[model samples]
Target: MGQLCLVAVMVGALTLALYVDAGRQAEQNAMERMRSLAASLAVNPFVIDAVQSPNPTALLQPYAVDVMDSAHADFVTIMQTDRTRFTHRYPSEIGGTFAGSIDDALAGRTVNQMQDGPLGPTIRGIAPIYSNDGRIVAVVSTGVTVENNNSQLLERLPLIIAIAATLLAGGAIVAVGLRRYLQRVTFGRGPEEIGQMYAFYDAVLHSIDDGMLLLSPGGELVLHNDRAAELLGLTLREGVSAEHSAATGQLPSELVSLLASGKTVENEVVLVGDRVLLVSQRAARTGGKAGSSLGTLVILRDRTDLRKLSSELDTVHTMADALRSQTHEHANRLHTMVTLVELGKGDEAVRFATDDLAQGQRLTDRVMESVDEPVLSALLVGKTAQADERGIELSIVTEGRIPSGLIDVHDAVTILGNLIDNALDAVAEQASPDDRWVEIELIASATELVLTVIDGGPGLRGVSPDDILRRGYTSKPGNGFGRGVGLALVTQAVRRSRGTLSVQDRATASEGARFTVVLPITSDANLNGNTAPVTPTPDRKAPQ
Candidate 1:
């Protein structure tokens, strides 16, 4: 509305100025023509001769009338140097003194002016008529009435008004169209509402823990939250396309693939650099009934910590099962002893109880001797109990001692725990439970911690070891969520510790599969004061 008002005001002001200027121009042209006519009449021999005659009015009256009629002038007059009229269109005024000033003409000069005359306001031109002797004998004056000039201007007024109206109409139309376009772009919301929504969305996008990326349908990176840029190690910019990032190797190829596919991806686990992320994607489309594709929204959740927690949870559940199994077995043995005592066979009960106690004590003592790291020993003991419950024989071989803090307990748990668990699964899958067995070797030295696990079960038939270490690669069917991540988690931990993992198939199916992991343990002195020795008590509650 303000724009419209401004345009209207400008048009009106411009038109008014033009109108006044045009009127002035028209008046100037009319005065010029009248001056020319008066000069011509003043030079006429008939008018000059009559001006010198004794009775000038009678002879000059008809001639003046004819000149006025031919020139379409309002009036023409012939006057003497004394300012007395010689000829006038009004016959009664002939020989009367002229009412208007003609001093310049009387003094042998021509002049023009807008002044009051017999015809009221008029543009009058007066000129001197000279005798044959070059004496000023009379003056000729001609005029165009102001009323006629106004009427002429009015004739052209409609055109000027039409032009101004056209321009104003065009401006109004354009302004209205622009307003509508802005309204649509803003979703019919006012400036305040749009600003508030923008602020709110900005806050939500940055405040969330998960990473988010919005892309156009053509795979251009439209928006990315701070977390997404940090997580993916991306330096985002406006209008940077996904293909460009991929070509430059700035963005992961897997994410680029999802964006280009334009298909919804749900909770797909992908390894991005050293971090594991669970990525989900959805198509963002217009909200209309016939929805058009706008782009894709990619959501990334950093599952690195989550995956670690899950692995620790798995170890906890395994220990819990092992403890429960041991408790059940101990309870059975205790019941037997109690029954023996009730039957009055106290001597037999004592022998049986001692034998059971000695066997358990020997296994613990052997594990404690083999590994000095309390966490690894405790993990092995729990595994031993778990293996016993499943009727699988478990053996541990330790060739070297692990220095205090050489290997982080959590990393050890992740590496050894996963390998041992995979071995146990392989052994338990065998048809003959009697022949099922898992063997583990922990060899720690000043340089590295080498762990090897061999399972007596069906070998990894024709499967690549590298393929097994890949995320989401699993051989067991119906193992569910926690099945495939164990080996991948172990691989991640191993790589972080600057370690290497290898797989070896046994010579025969009866021998089973062997897996080895060698993790380099940097010395505390070489760590630049960044690490200290971890010496926690040997307990099941220790973190893996």
Candidate 2:
């Protein structure tokens, strides 16, 4: 609408100007024609002879009428030096005084002016007729009336209309084109609406707690909030190109890949420094599903703290479930021993109880001696019970004492716990329960700690190790809601600790997989580990 109004104003102004200019040109042409006709008559030899004769009107009146008709002028008058008309368009008024100035004509001059005359208002030209002796004999005047001038101006009306129509059509086309362009660019928003939208968007972007990134189609950093900067550990400004950011090593390779792929992903775990972020990404389109790609939008949620809490909660639940199973098993054994003693089989009851005590005691003592960290020891104990409940043999072996503060407790749990759970799940799939087994090895050296979990079950079976490590890749069949992500979590935790993880077919077992992780733990002075690990109270009733 604004465009249309502007075009209308412009066309109207231009048309008015053209009309005014045409009127001026028409008036000029009329005046020039009249002046030329009057000058030509004043120089005619017949008019010069007639003007000096005794009866000049007899010869001049008819001649003046003929000239007037030929020149398309309203009137032509021949007058004396004293301004007495001798010849005129009206024969009866031939002797009447000419209603015009002839003083200049009498002074041997030619004049052109708009003046009131016998023919009402007119544009007239006057010229003096001089004898061969160069004395003024008479004057001739020719004019076109105001009405005739108007008729001449109307003659060019069609051309003026054509020009005006062309201008209007051109303006409308330009206006429509501009309107469509603006609509596409601005989403049909006016200046004020666009300004308001910008204000609202800025407020929302800054107010959001989650890290947000807006990229252009070319992957340039169009916008990023403060939270995004803090989470990504990047000092960024607007308009930073993607190449420059990647070259500067500010954006992590995972994030750069996501941006480049232009694929939509949700809740993807990305490890940046020591932070674990759950990133959600989608491509932004301008209009709708069919619209062109605008860019990719990424939202990052800091899941570091939540993951730690979840890890701890999972450990507690595992311990509780394991303790419950142990309680039930012990109760069943005690009942059997009581029945044996009641049946006078005290020797058998004592032997059976002693055997159970010895086996449980040795395993507990081994784990405590190998792992000084209480959380890991407790985790292993609980996992051992869970394995026994599922009829699978679980073994935990260690090369050296894993002292406290070797690695972050949460990272330790996320890595070791998930690996064990994954292994247990894998081995539980074996058809022969007696042949199923999972083993854990924690080797602590002066410079690093290596954790390995092996499972006896169907191996990778030609599946890529890298594919299994990606999120949402699970061998187990189900609804697949939370099917895959254990290994991904492990990967993220391993990366956070500046560690490495690898998966391969278990060489010891014909159909099993082995996973290994190496985490650096140099020294107290050089280590960039998290807070010191905390010791938990061990199960006092374990075979004691």
Candidate 3:
């Protein structure tokens, strides 16, 4: 519509300009013709001879009338060099002075000007009549009155109007066609509506908590939300290809591969820097199911905190299972003691109860002596009961005692708890339950905390130590939601604490895997002589 209106205005202006130019040109041509006629009359012998006659008006007046009719002039006048009229179209005005400038004509020049005369306003021309001796003898003037010029222009007014109307009609048609084309291109939306939709969509895209990515079919990034850039730790710019993104080493190579593959991926766990993201991707189609694919939509949900919470939940479940097992074991022990007393074997019952109490007390004392952190002590006790229920021997060996306030409970549980659970799983895989045994060692000093877990099971089978810590990399496979994040979580906790984790496979002795973690303990005044909780940095790089 705007285009249409603009075109209309332009066409109207052009038409007006054309009309004005044409009218000006016509008026100029009329003036030039009058000037030429006047000069021609001044050069005529009859007018020059009459101007010198004793009775000039009789000879020139009739001649002037004849010239006016032939040249289509409004009036013709013959005047002397002294401005006295020799002949005039009005006979009564003969012998009177002309009413317009004759100084140029008297000075022997031909000229034209617009002036008011006896008849009215006119475009008049004057030319000098010179004798053979080169002296001005008379002046001849010709004019076209303003009224007559306007009548001539009026005769062509209809044609000018017709052209203008035609042009206006053509412009209107073109404008209407252009307006329809614009409407089709814009999906029938007005400018205001389109602007509103753009603003709404932009707000919604950035407002989401999860990261969103839109990619072309060729794997070029089309759009990305703010959260996507924040989560991935990369400045996302539009039109960058997946290959280029991977080359920067900021985005994970695995994620790039998935994007380039153009295949649908669901709930796939991917490690981007130090953050774990649950990534889902689908091909974006233009229309329905059979429509062509336009691009791919990728969503990244931050699972770092969620995975930690899941790890904590797993610990809670393990503790509950251990408690249930302990309760059952205590019931059996009570039954045995009751039967012994009822069968008249009071000494045997006493010895049986004494040995049971002694073993339980020993395990509790070992855990208490090794770990001063209540969380770690409680975790180890729960593991002991779990190991006992599985008929596996669990031992806690301490070379140096861990002090209270030296570690965050969550971090300690995540690292050591996951390690013990993985060992337990390895030991449980053994065919001989009697041979299943796990050992844990805790060593702490003023500077560092060291933990080690070893199991009596088949070793890593030449698996790389780094490979075991990769998320979703597991030998024992089952379709479980939280199956393979244990070692990965352990690695994350260790790294956050600025610690080191090492895995040793004893392929010869014991044929088991040994895992060790060393965490540095900081004793700053701000921390009140306690170990500061390890917090992951925003730009921390994850292990490859």
lDDT of candidate 3 at residue 107, scale 0 to 100: 77
TM-score of each: 0.63, 0.68, 0.65
Error of 2 at 330 (Å): 2.1
What lDDT would candidate 2 get against the real structure?
A: 0.82
- Sort order, lDDT high to low: 2, 3, 1
Error in Å for residue 280 of model 2:
8.2
Best by lDDT: 2
lDDT of 3 by residue, 352-414 (tens): 999999988988897787577787788899998998898777877676567767776777888
Measured by C-alpha RMSD in angstroms, how accurate is candidate 2? 7.9
lDDT (Cα, tens digit) per residue for candidate 1, span 1-544: 9879988998999899989988998899889999999999999988888888888877988887888888888889888877888777678887688878888887777889889877789998999888899888778899889999889899999999999999999989988998899887776888899999999999999999999999987788899899998888878774878989888887888677667877776766566777777778898767663677768889998878875676577668778987998999999999999999999999999999999999999988877765667877778889999999988888777665655577777778888888888888887877776548887777655566678787786777788776676544567785244456677777777777888988888744456787878888786524332222333212111011
Off by over 4 Å in 1: 1-160, 164-187, 226-235, 246-254, 272-275, 285-293, 302-312, 328-370, 391-399, 422-446, 452-488, 500-517, 525-544
| Two-way lDDT contest, 2 vs 3, winner | 2
lDDT of each: 0.79, 0.82, 0.80
Return the clash pairs for model 3, or none: none
Top candidate, metric TM-score: 2
Write candidate 2's Cα lDDT for 259-285 as tens digits.
677778787766677676778899888
